[model samples]
Target chain A: MKDTTAHIVEVCPRDGLQNERRVVATEDKIALIHRLIAAGARRIEATGFVHPGRVPQMADAEAVLAGIGPHPGVALIGLVLNRRGVERAVATGALDEVNYVVPLTDSFGKANQGQTTAESLAALPVVRSMAADAGLRTTVTVAVAYGCPYEGDVPVARLREAVRAIADTGPDEVAVADTIGCAVPADVTSRLRAVREVCALPLRTHFHQTRLTALGNVHAAMLEGVTVHDASAGGIGGCPFAPGAGGNAATEDLAWLLHRGGHTTGVDVDAVTRAGRWICDVLGVPPRSAMAHAGPFPTSHPPRGPG
Target chain B: MKDTTAHIVEVCPRDGLQNERRVVATEDKIALIHRLIAAGARRIEATGFVHPGRVPQMADAEAVLAGIGPHPGVALIGLVLNRRGVERAVATGALDEVNYVVPLTDSFGKANQGQTTAESLAALPVVRSMAADAGLRTTVTVAVAYGCPYEGDVPVARLREAVRAIADTGPDEVAVADTIGCAVPADVTSRLRAVREVCALPLRTHFHQTRLTALGNVHAAMLEGVTVHDASAGGIGGCPFAPGAGGNAATEDLAWLLHRGGHTTGVDVDAVTRAGRWICDVLGVPPRSAMAHAGPFPTSHPPRGPG
Candidate 1:
């Protein structure tokens, strides 16, 4: 089998927990991170630096980050929207990278960040500058690159234009997000190919399993040479703004698929599944992951020999 | 975009209902079939002709099939495990094809049908002959083609040999089944390619969503030029024998993915989702389909123009 290795960035704490109506305790949040690291997750999006009034679920961002130990080789990341958010993330002293979003459509961009698409793009340089000055790595997530809940299907030309604008900021990586989980394989293939044309930086994908095509979309993008992905444990979290949007692709499912497809994700599916079950238990919701429900492939009892 | 069209065989009625503990009324089953047809499903597995005692959920198969109107261009298929099942299916006068299962593993075969793998293969010729005499189409599904519940991983060479044997019997179509939902893309690719090398007949696939790799595996198989697939509405149906097996790939999800991938499945996703939701209500179970849960892509709420 060919080597199909990729980097996986776990976004459960930030993107996953942010949408929960019930706030996860800071200690539980820290435990989830520990569980993730134990599952071989080297990169994790720890929390969002948004206003607590807007998303109280992530209000314990600073406290949660403070509780985590400085594990070497683990890229603890935080999501930020603007300069002030960047400053708040840097103040946490727990984030190795600061992530930001720039939706391709003005309606979604404005609704999400109180800025138009052009304004969001224009603010990227400042956000990057601040994060860089803080000695933090950076990644810009192009939200709704596949489709906009408000604007409907986005054109490839618009995505190419957005990718060019975001790439110009010289961030370490750029991620195309399916905020509403509306994208299918062809959409992923066409849009990712278009984004790859203008952006030379490493590309990442954030997919929602709302329409049950996230895994397929991930495979489609992987075939187009994309490796880095943002997935949540137990397939938790949906877009709070996008109606009917489901959770992100489960980290364990992604790891299982990637590993079975000859890709080296360096993540243990069983360990992730354990943590996934734990988080879902914490939230009082069923884990929506198929892997979590079905167990691993070739599932068997320990000690293969019969009695 | 390349036209990646595939023939989708909806197995909701037969496969989906068979495992349900609660036996749905015959009228409701007929209603589900009508809804599937309204959604543009031309090929549908109506019910299994297995012994009523063995699968009481399908005990009213004859009544359900008898109630369905024989619409033009629609092929109503029935599942059969033995020669007696072939006889019963032929007597139904409502089926266009008689489908049989010949699991690749003897343990599973014997456990499922009280016959070894070789015995099941030996019975295929007689079943095909009986179905052909009745002017009915024939399909032999090689269950556990991906992996066995008892035997674990099945080798590619074994699949190739089994496909060769099944093809030699000259069934109209041969289906490679992931009975336990254990197959990944590489497994689908390698095994399907191997099966393709031996069988000249049209191919089909039956996948379980156990590990959430079903959609991804379908995409992989589609890329390998294998189109025909077996999917259930609302992602219903789990293997009664395979422990921890998830449901089949949901029909609405498959149609959504295929249509978005530029394939003409000719199925209305919204209509299928409506039926999917209805059937789940009848079963008193939550719809396992993401499409049913998330709604269709480009979800609209009417009035495109601003008031």
Candidate 2:
């Protein structure tokens, strides 16, 4: 099998918890991060620096970071939307990287972060500079890059222009997000191709499993030469600002898909599934992942005759 | 965009309900078939002609066929296990096609149909002859073509041998089924390529979403030029004989993926989503489809600001 080793950025702590109606205890959030680390997650989005009133589930960002002290080898990431958010992340002294969000459309930009698209674009370089000055690796994630809930079908020309603007910000990496999970494989292929035309930075993809096309989209991205992808443990996530958004691609499921496709994600599927089930238990919600329920393939139990 | 017109074989009435704990009413099963036809499904697996004692959910197969009567542009398919099932289906006078199963592994063959792999292969030609004499089209479906719950992964060489045997049976079409849903894109690509090298017959694919790799596998098959695929409305399905099997690839989700990929499946996404929801209501189970809850993209609703 050809080696197609991939990197999975665990985002359960930030994007996964941000949409839950019930807030997770700070200790449990820390425990989830610990569990994900034990499952071989080297890069994890630990928490977001958004307003508590807007996303209550992520209100304990500082406390959770304080609870999870320092760990060698693992890169902790903090999500931020603006300059103030970047400052908060830098103050925590916990995150090694800070991911800044830049919505592709004005509607989502206003609803999600109270900024216009152009305003967010203008803040991108400032946010990157602030994080870089603070010794934090920077990644700019273009939110709603596939299709916006309010402004449907973002054109390739628009995405190319946005990628050009984002690339100019000099971020360490760029991630295109399917905020509403409306993109299919063709969309992923076309959009990623367009993004690559204008930007040569390392590409990452974040997809929601709302329409059950996330895995297919991931496969398309891999075929397009993208190696880094984002997934939430147990597939627990949704966009609080995007109406009807669903969970991110489950980390365990994505690991299984990649491993079966001859890609080494370095993430243990069984441990991630346990963590997914554990977090789902913490939130009092059923897991949205198939691997959480189906168990891994190649069982040792002998086959039985039909009952 | 490539003109990849695909054929969707809606299997809700047969494979979808067969594993349900609560047996669906015959009238409701017929109603589902009608609704699927209304949603532009030209090919449908209406029901199975199997031992009622073995699969009680399909006990009302004859009644369902009687209720449906006839439709002008639809081709109703009936799933069968052995020569006896072919006879029963031929006597119904309702089925346009008979799908006979040939398990790739002996353990699954015995558990599912009380026969060994060799015995099933021996009976395939006889079953095909019986169905052909009755003027019914034939489709030989190799069960667990991807992986078997009892025998783990089915080797490509084994699949090639089985497809050659199945081809000798002179069936109109061949369907390789991931009954245990253990296949990823690479598995689908390699296995289908192996089958194609041995057989020149038109190929189809049947996949369960047990591990959520069904859509990805479908996309892989489409890339391999196998245009006919199987899916169930509401994604309601599992194999009672196959331990830990989940639902089939959902019709609405499959349609959404294919339509977005620029392939014409001729299946209406909204109508199929409504039908999926309706069937889930009757089955007293939440829909296993994403489109059922997220609704179709490109919504008419205007964007709203954060509350």
Candidate 3:
């Protein structure tokens, strides 16, 4: 039987593109989202409804959201950091899910949102209530869940305390973001174990390739039973703190790692690699995904279907 | 009982310095070896006894070999490619082990050694016999065992056939080299399994970080009963295929992966990461190993010990 066990969310269109210096014309962002969904992503984080003054790249997020075709089984997600972003995202009526991000480290939260971690936590309840009132699936993504950049490392106690505070918001899922990519496999497994103790909800993992252990960290998380993963086409994504730090684990590379580990990622490796190589030309940087230029497994050399 | 299981062979002195265009001083190579042995590497690939005219990088290999300080238990290994290389290596009286490399793919062998795969294979038995007669431990390292840059995906049939041919030579062990970073976890497990069926000797797997699957591949190999791993200090080695293609798997990263997997790697992750960062600066490149920047586990601004 074809497995339908997990969901892979391709976040390149939104998270990946938001950091670029060159504007990717709203048309390209729209094109990227549609392509990711067609390529087997059940969920795509389409855009963030942040203030244009803060993220001008996402100013036209509504247009990108408008461009998506009505995919019957797929979900469109939009990110929001505060109540205003949520209200704006709710106005679009395009997002099935709205993710609320609250970084765990005070230094990171202050830099990212100009507030302390406690202040972000205080806002989560109202934001979660608003999304729930709008019948939206609420997910709270804790930035630097495994560790942090400015703060060095976020302790399990610090993360668990944030999880407890956010748990009061009644979100459906909690995603641990390795914003600075400082996590090793041990860090991933230990933090996931600690969080699983307090929160009984589904867990998701997001990793960056800064230290090359992103995929391995994902594997360690999956071994502990994580059901959803966050990735970008061509591994394109960035942190506001570490500019030009390669892409979020490429959707194709993540798919390859999962499939090789005997899990069904359901994303085509060749098609994704080709798309990554194509987008590198668009972005003018080599992909952070290792498998992109390394070529596909020869046996997996995508049969052209007898044409 | 404390685990006595993890074994890693440091190859920086040989693999790290082999392809460099700028000639590093002989004293530096010797100092590097002194540090690695002091840091607990039981085996080290010290130098290559190749023709000086062809690989200018190794012109002082003999002199470097002569300057080595004593390590009571450390086994010094030298890389060899043919009967002549083996003859020259055994003459050193410095090598406790000689790794006879046979390029698995014909294209790479020709590019690397100006010989066809068949010629390299035909030469293995003679070298193995000579090493056996001289009472030196001979390790048959099949270069590009996982994938070849010149020749795309190398078949398991090719690797197994090569192993069987070399096994007949009665060498002490066999190692599979990921010449390019083309190997993945599934390949490591599946291909190593096929070889396990044909040969019962210990298996040593070496990998490159070219594609970021290096550590993942190593974890899979260890799961399949591989006891020995080959890694370079500071993740400082690479192939001349091109810059950014990737170098050898960084020593610290591999140790971290294995240690976190509940297996022993017997190397210090902090020391190795520091070495990786230092050596990267020495070579003027970002570390080839991922964990160099990603510090140790549970590593958040913990109390620095009197630093």
TM-score of each: 0.96, 0.97, 0.82
TM-score of 2: 0.97
lDDT of predicted model 1: 0.87
Give lDDT tens digits, candidate 3, residues B88-175: 8888778789998788877777666666778987887788778877878999788888776655667899889988888877789999
State the C-alpha lDDT per candidate. 0.87, 0.90, 0.76
True lDDT of residue A304, candidate 3: 29
Q: What is the lDDT of residue A180 in candidate 1?
A: 83
Candidate 1 deviant stretches above 4 angstroms? A302-307, B302-307
lDDT tens digits, residue span A1-307, model 3: 1223555788887778878777777777776666676678788898988778777888998888888868888888999989898998898888899988888877777767776788888988888888888889999899978766565656789888888877777899999888766676667778888898788888888888766777767766666788689988888778655432445888887887677556787787777777666666687877767667654444444322211
Q: What is the lDDT of residue B274 in candidate 3?
A: 69
Who is ahead in lDDT, 1 or 3? Answer: 1
Among all windows of 10 consecutive residues in model 3 chain B, the one with the lowest summed lDDT is: B298-307
Give the clashing pairs for model 1.
none
Q: Model 1, B45-147: lDDT tens per residue?
A: 9998888887888888888889998799999999999998988899988889999999888878766777778899888899999999999999999998988
* Stretches of model 2 off by over 4 angstroms after superposition: A302-307, B302-307
* lDDT (C-alpha) at residue B54 in model 1: 77
DockQ of each: 0.51, 0.60, 0.24
As a whole number from 0 to 100, the lDDT of residue A218 in candidate 3 is: 75
Per-residue lDDT value at A93 in model 2: 89
Query: Which ten contiguous residues of candidate 1 chain B have the minimum total lDDT?
Result: B298-307
